[model samples]
Target chain A: MNKPPTIVIIDYGCGNLFSIQRALTELDVPSTISRNPDEIAKADKIILPGVGAFGKGMENIRRFGLLEVLGAFVASGRPVLGICLGMQLLMRASHEFGYHEGLHWIPGQVTKLRPGQPGEETVKIPHVGWSPVNFNSNNDGLFHRLQNGTYMYFLHSYFVTTENPMCGIATTTYGNNVFCSACCKENIVGVQFHPEISGPSGLRLLQNFVFLK
Target chain B: MKNRRIIARLDIKGPNLVKGIQFDGNRALGLSEDFAYLYYQEGADEMIFYDTVASLYRRNNLIEFVTAVSKHIFVPLTVSGGIRNVEDVQKILRAGADKVAINTAAIANTSLIKISAEAFGSQCVLAGIEAKRKENGDYEAWVDYGREPTGVNVVEWAQRVVDFGAGEILLTSIDREGTGNGYDLELTARVAQSVPVPVIASGGAGRKSHVLDVIHEGRADAVAVASMFHYYYAKPLQRMYSSTNADGLRLGAQIDEGNLEFLNARYGGILERRFDPISVKGLKSFLAGSGIQCRNM
Candidate 1:
C-alpha cells in the first residue's frame, strides 16, 4: 500500500494552530505547518484553519502574500478544507465589520447570524454549542460515514449562504433558519463548525477528509 | 434559535479539581484531566475550566491540563479565571482553549472586553459575571470570584458587556451555588432578557427541573452544572487510582482529602437523589422527554 500522504497546515496566524496539530498528531497523520509558498505548493493536501473576523483574517492573508498562492492551490484540485473563518474567507464577500471581499472560490456571502429574520425566530447572535446536522446519507461526502442527524460542535455569529444550493453537503436548523453547516463542491470543502474541538464524530469527519483523493 | 447547551463546569485548585459551597469549603478531587476526559466521553455539550484561585495566586496554571485534554476531547473548552489581559487570553487560547471567560479584568477595564472581541471575534469572547441578590430583591454584580461587590446591577452589567463586545455571558449566582436549591431564575431571566447574546445559567443546579426552569423561565441559552454532574463521577475514580498522575504526588493530598469518603459514608444514598448524577446521554433524553427542546447525540 502507498504511504499515507503528508498534510500541510497553513499558519495564517489567526486560527488555533496548536490544537489542529494536536488533533492531527493524535490521528497519527504526519503534517507540517508552513508559511512559505514553496512548502505549501509541494504538499498533497492543505487545511485552512482560522478563528476571527473576516476583515482581519483577509488583512493577515494579504500581508503574508498567500492570496495568489492559495488561489493556485484551489485551482490545482487537491483537497482543501476551510474551517470556520477559513471557510468564511472562501466566499465571495462578507458583511462583518465592513464590506470585505473573500477568496470567491465558493459563490456565497457571509452574514451575521441574527435572532430575527423573515421566517426565522429570534435566536441569539453568536450561536454557541453542539447542535445536530442534517447530512444526506447517500452523498458519501466528508460526513457520509456518520449518521444522518449526527451532532457536531458549532460556535459562530456568521454563516455561509451559498448561491448554488447543491454545494451544501449538510444543513442545520437554528430557530427557523436552515443554513448550510458543511459546504462541499468537488475537492473544496468548508465547515462552519470546528472539527478539531468536536470529538469522535468530528475526528471521523477529519478522517474522511484525510482519505479523500 | 440554537440548541441549548449542557456545559460541565470544573473549578480547579492547581491540578486537582476542588468542590466548594459558595466559594468556600473547597475539597479536592482527583486529576482535572481525568474528569474532563470522562465528561467528554459521556457527551457533554461544552466544558468550562474556571480556576477558583488563579487570580488570587497571580498565575494561570491550567496550560498543561488544557494541552493534555485538547488532544482527544474535541469539544469547546472555555477557560476562565486569572485572565488579566488580552495577552493572557492569547496565551490561554494557544494552550488549546477555544474561548476565554473574563470577569476581573473585564470589570476592571471594560475596554478589555471590546478590544478582545475586536481582536478575536464575538464568538471567542465570553463575559463571566458573578452576581449576588441584595435585600431589595435586586441582583448586584460581584467581582474577585464573588468575594467583592462591584455595586453594579446584574442586568446593567450584562447589557454593558454586550454593548462593549461580549458575545456570550456566563452568569453564576453566588448565594445559590452548591446549595442544591436550583438556579436564581429571576436573576438569570433579567440578564438573558437584556442581552442579545447567549446566557449560560450557572450555580444552584440540583435537578433536571432546575435546568428546565432556568431555560424556559429564565430565558437562558445554556445550563452549567458542577456537583449535579461531578459528584457521582469522581468518587469511584478516586478509589480506582492511587497516584494522581505520572508525578510522584500521591492522590488525596489536600487538607480536606477525606471529604469525598466522609460524604460517601454519611450521605451517599441520598447524594444521587439530591444532585441526581444524570449521565450526559440520559440528561438529553430526560430533557427531550420532558418536552423541553435540546439537541440529542
Candidate 2:
C-alpha cells in the first residue's frame, strides 16, 4: 500500500490557514503550515490560502522569496491548489489597491465583477455567500468526481479571465454570463470559492482534492 | 432595490449578554436564548454575535454560541470577534454561522477579507469597519476594539474592503454608539456611495425612526442596534412593525396572532405575548446553560 501524500499549506501573512489545515486533517491527510520556501519546495502538494489585497499578498510572497520556490514546485508537476486570494495571486496581475503583478503561474489577469450589459443593475462587488459552481470539465482531475451544477460557497470580487479557455475547468454565473468561478491547468487548480466553508458538498470537494492524482 | 435588513447585535461577556454605551457602559440584559428566539420570532433579518472577550483571551467561543442559537432560530447568524484566520472562519461556518465577521484582523492584514471571502464565498465574509468622527472633520477607521486609530479614511477603506472581496460592510460609529443620537448619516452615506457591497449601519440607534433614517438617508442596507434593543431602552418592535408604511416596505409582515399563539403554546409560554425589551444578562445566562456563549458589549 502506498502512503498518502503530504500536503503543505502556505502561510505568508494571509488569512485562515488553520481552517484548511483542519479540513485536511479531518480527511486523515498529513499536512503542515509553513511560510518557508524550503518547506514548500519539499512538500508532496502545496495549498496556497490567502486573504486581503492581491498586490500586497503577492508582495509578501516576493518579499519572503517564495515566488521562485513556488514556480519551481509547479514546474516539478506536483499538485498546487490556490484558494480565494491565493487563486487570484496565480493570475498575471490585479488592479487591487493599484495595479500589481501576481505570480503569473496561470495566464490571466484579475478584474472586478461588473454589470455585463448596458443599463444593467451593477452586480455589486464581493459576490458573497453560497452560489452554485457549474463544472465545465469532466476529465479535470481537480474536479474529477464532482458533478456539474454543484452548489459551493463563494466570496470574491475579482475573477480570472484567461486567454486560454481550456484552463477554466468550471465557471459560475453572477449577474450575467461573466466568470463567477474557475479552475486551471492540471496540477494547478484555483477555485474562487472556499470548499472548506461550503458545508458537506465543499467538504467532499476537499476530500477529492486530497485523494486526487 | 435590495431589501433593508434589521439586525440585532448580541454582545457576550463571560456567561451573560451585556449592553453599554460608547462601547463601554456595560450592563447585563437577558439570556441569549430568549432574546435570540424572541428576535427571530419578531422577524429579525439577521443576528450578529460579537464575543467582546475573544480578542482579549485570543480564542473564539462564538462558534459554539452560534451553533446553540442556530438550533432555535432559522434566520442567518453572523459571529465575530477573535477571528484571525481562514481556519477560524471555517470553524464558525461549520458550527452553523451563516457569516463570519472580521474586524481587527482585517485592519491588521486587510487581505483576510479577500482570502476569507474567496475561500468561504463573499456572502459568508463580512468586514466590520469601526469608524469615529475625528476632529479633522473626516471619519477614520479604528481597530483594537475601537481603541486604536488606523488613520485610514473610512470611505477609502470601505471601497478597498469591497475590492478585497468583502460581501458586506458592518460600519459602527464609535461616537454615536451609545448616544442613540441617530446613525452617522454623513459617514454612512459616504461609505455606501464609495463601495458597491451592502453597508450595515451600527451604533446610536435610539428609536425606530433612526432605523428608517439610516435606511433612507444613510442609504444603509441594514441597521444594527445593541443598547436600544438589549436594554429595552427603546421600542424596537414598534419601529419594526411601523416600517410597513414606508414606500419600499422591506420589513417582513408581522407574525399573525394564530401563529403567535401556536408559538407561545409550543414554547410553553416562554415567548412573550408582545415584543418588548428584555434583559441582556438574563438572556445570556439562559443560553449559557444551554451551551451558548454570550458576550456583552
Chain B TM-score per candidate, please: 0.90, 0.77
lDDT of 2 by residue, A155-177 (tens): 66778887688888788877664
**Which DockQ values do the candidates obtain, in the order shown?**
0.72, 0.08
Candidate 2 lDDT by residue in tens digits, B68-149: 7665454557887889988898889777677888988888888898998777657678899999998978999987666778
Q: Rate the local accuracy (lDDT) of all candidates.
A: 0.82, 0.71
In candidate 2 the C-alpha lDDT for residue B154 amounts to 88
iRMS of each prediction in angstroms? 1.8, 10.4
Residue B206, candidate 1: alpha-carbon lDDT: 84
For model 1 the local lDDT of residue B8 reads 92
lDDT of 2 at A174: 72
RMSD of 1: 3.0
User: Top DockQ: which candidate number?
Assistant: 1
